[model samples]
Target: MLVEPERTAYDLRFRLLGFPIRIHPLFWLGAALLGAFTLNMGFQYLLIWMAVVLVSLLVHELGHAVMFRWFGTNAAIVLYVFGGLAIPQAFVAGRWRRILISLAGPLAGFLLCAGVYVSNRQFHWASNPEGFLTGGREVGFFYLALLWVNLYWGILNLLPVFPLDGGQVSRELCGLVWGPRGTRIALQISLAVAVALVAYSLLCVLTANGPALAVVPWWLPRGTIFTAILFGLLAYTSYQLLQQLRWTDSSWDDRVPWER
Candidate 1:
C-alpha cells in the first residue's frame, strides 16, 4: 500500500530547491478523503485542510530529501496516495545515515509545529488556547489543522510499523544488531506493533462516545474507523511480507518500496 504509483500524464510536476517533485493525482484525492470530515465546517475549511496536508507533507519529504543531499546524493520527492517518498539517485551506504534520513522527516514536522506554536503565541493569533481550539473561526481551524497534521500525524508516522519512518529506523537498527536476520526481526516487530495499534484504534472507536470514555485517559487520541482500517491493512501487509521472507533466505531487502 505504501508503494509508489506509476507516473501518468495527469501528474503534476514541479521542482523546489533543486529537487524534482511529482504529485500524483491520487495525492489530492487522498488528502480530500482524509479531510472530508472538515466538510461539516464548510467547503472552505475542507480546502484549508487540504492546504495544510500539502504543506505539512511537503515539508516532511523535503526533510528527507535534504538529508539525502547531505549524504552526497540527489533525491526526488513523490507525493502519492499514502504520503511521500524521497528516492535517492544512489544508495546511501551507511546504516546510521539511513536512520538519520528516516528521522529527518518527523523532525522537520516537529520543527514546523514548534514554529506554528511560537508564531501564534507571539502574534496572539488566539488569546485563549482553549477558545482557540473550540472557536469556529476559519483561521483558528487553519492553525489547528497545521498543528494537528504536523504534531499528531508526525507522531503517528513515528510508530514502528512497516513503511513508516520509524519502521525504517527500526529495520536499520535491527540490522545493525542482528546482522542478516534483522530484516525478519524488524518485520515481526512491525507486525506486532501494527496489530496492537489496530486493536487500540478499534477500542478508541468503541469508547469515543460510550460510557467507557470515563475510563480512558484524557490525553489519549480518539480514533476513527479510518485509523482502525488503515492499521488493519498495515498489519496484513506486514504479515504477507513476513511470510514472503520466511520462504526465502530469512533476509529481506531493506529498501523503500520506491527503490525496490
Candidate 2:
C-alpha cells in the first residue's frame, strides 16, 4: 500500500516549484469515488470536489518535497490510488530531519486551511444566506471541502499507524528510546491503533452514526466505512511487517540507511 506506483501511459506529468509530479490514472478515480456523495447535488459540485482534492493533495505532497529539498535531497511527487507519495531521489540521513519531512505534509495542509479560513473571514465568503452550511453555494462548498479534507484528513494521517507520517515519527522516537527493538515496538503500536480505529469505524457504520459518536461529541471526528477499510488494510500491513521483522536474524531494522 505504501509503495510507489509504476508510471503509466495515461499518467499526467507536470512540475511545480521545481518538483516533478506524476498523477496516476487511479488518482482521479479515487478522488471521484471519495467525493461521490457530492454528485447528489449536481455534477458541477463533484467537479468542485475534485478540484479541491487535486489542490489539497498537491499542497500536501509539495510540503514533503520542500522539506526534502531543504535537507539537500530532491524528491518527486506521485499521486496514486491510496493517496500521494513524495519519493526522495536521494536519501537524507538524520532521524530528526526525516521526522520533520514526514510532518511537513500535514503541517502544510493546516497552513492552507488557516489561509482559507482567514480569506473567508476577510471577504465574508463563508456567509450563507440560505442559512445552510453550503446553501447550494459553490464558493461555500469549495471552502467546506477544502477545510474538511485538510483538517480532518490531516488529523487522521497523524495517527500512529504504519506508513503514515505519525507512524514514521513514532518509529523514529521508539528507535531513539528502545534501540534495536524500536521498529518492532513501533509496528506493534501501529497495529494496535489501526485495529482500534477499524473497530470504531465499523461501529460507526453499523449504527449509521457516520463520523459522530454518542461519547465522541458532534465536534470530534470519528470514522466511516472508508476509514474502516483504510485502517484495516494498514493494520494488516503492520502485522505483515511485524512478522517479517521477527524472522530477520540480523539486528538491523527493515529499512536500510538509504531506504530510510
Candidate 3:
C-alpha cells in the first residue's frame, strides 16, 4: 500500500493556555468548513448545538493534552471537522503512558455527558414551559442533543478499531499478551473490523432512508471522497506498522519499538 502525504495550506504555530501548539493548515481549513456548515443551519437552536459540539470536542482533546503532560510528554491538540486530534511528540515513551493518553479523550467526553445529565435531571428543563421562556426557545433541546452526541461520540471512540483512540488502547493491551509482532497483527485485524463497521454504518444509513440522500448537495461527493481517503490512510498506516514489526523480527536483536 502506498501512503499519501498530507497537504497543508500554511503551518500555524500558536499557544493555548500556556501550551505550545502547532496546527497544519488542512486542519484549520476543515475547522473553517465545519464552522460554516454548522452555522449555516440559521437557527438559534442549531447554533447552540454547534457551539456545544465544538466545545465538547475541544475538551476531549484537552483531556489527551493534560494526560500527556502528566506523563511528561510534549503534546498538542487540534480541533478539526469530525472531532479533535491530539498529537504527542515522539519522546513520549512507555506503553502505560500511551494507553492513558489514548483513553483520556473519550473519558473527558463521557464526563461532560454525565454532568449534563445530572443538570437536566436536577433542573427539569424539559418538563417546565417556563424553562424555555427563561432560557430562550428550545435551549433545553439543544442541551439534550449536545449531551447525547457527546455521550455517543465518547462510547464510539472506545471501539477497538484502527485510526481511533480506542484502537491505540487495544494495541497497547494486546502488546502485553502478544508482544510487538502480535500487536501489529492485531492492528491489521482491527482495520478489517473498522472496514466492516463502515460498511454496516452505511447500510444502516441507507436503510433508514435519511435526508442525506434526497438532499444531495455538491459537497456530498466531496465528503464521500474525503472519507475514502481517510480509510486509505488508515490502511496504509496499519501496513507500515506491520512492516516495521516484520523488520524487527528479521533482525538479530528482535527489538520492536512498539513492544510493551
Question: Which candidate gets the maximum TM-score versus the true structure?
Answer: 2
Clashing pairs in 3: none
Taking the tens digit of each residue's C-alpha lDDT, what string does model 3 give over 1-260?
Answer: 22222435565567776566545555545545544544645666555666676667777888888898888776767654466677777567888988988899999888988887777667765445344433444665567666876786687678776667878788888887787455876777777765655554454355553554555553322223344455556656776777776687577564566852
As a whole number from 0 to 100, the lDDT of residue 57 in candidate 2 is 92
Question: Looking at candidate 1, what is the lDDT of residue 20?
Answer: 98
Per-residue lDDT of 10-49 in model 1, one digit per residue for the tens? 8999999999999999999999999989877799988989
The best candidate in terms of lDDT: 2
Query: In the order shown, what is each candidate's alpha-carbon RMSD?
Result: 5.2, 4.4, 7.0
Model 3 per-residue lDDT at 190? 71
TM-score for all models, in order of appearance? 0.90, 0.91, 0.69
lDDT of 1 at 93: 96
Arranged by lDDT, best first = 2, 1, 3
TM-score result, candidate 1: 0.90
Q: Which residue pairs in model 1 clash with each other?
A: none
Q: What is the lDDT of every predicted structure here?
A: 0.87, 0.89, 0.66
Q: Deviation in angstroms for 110 in model 3?
A: 0.5
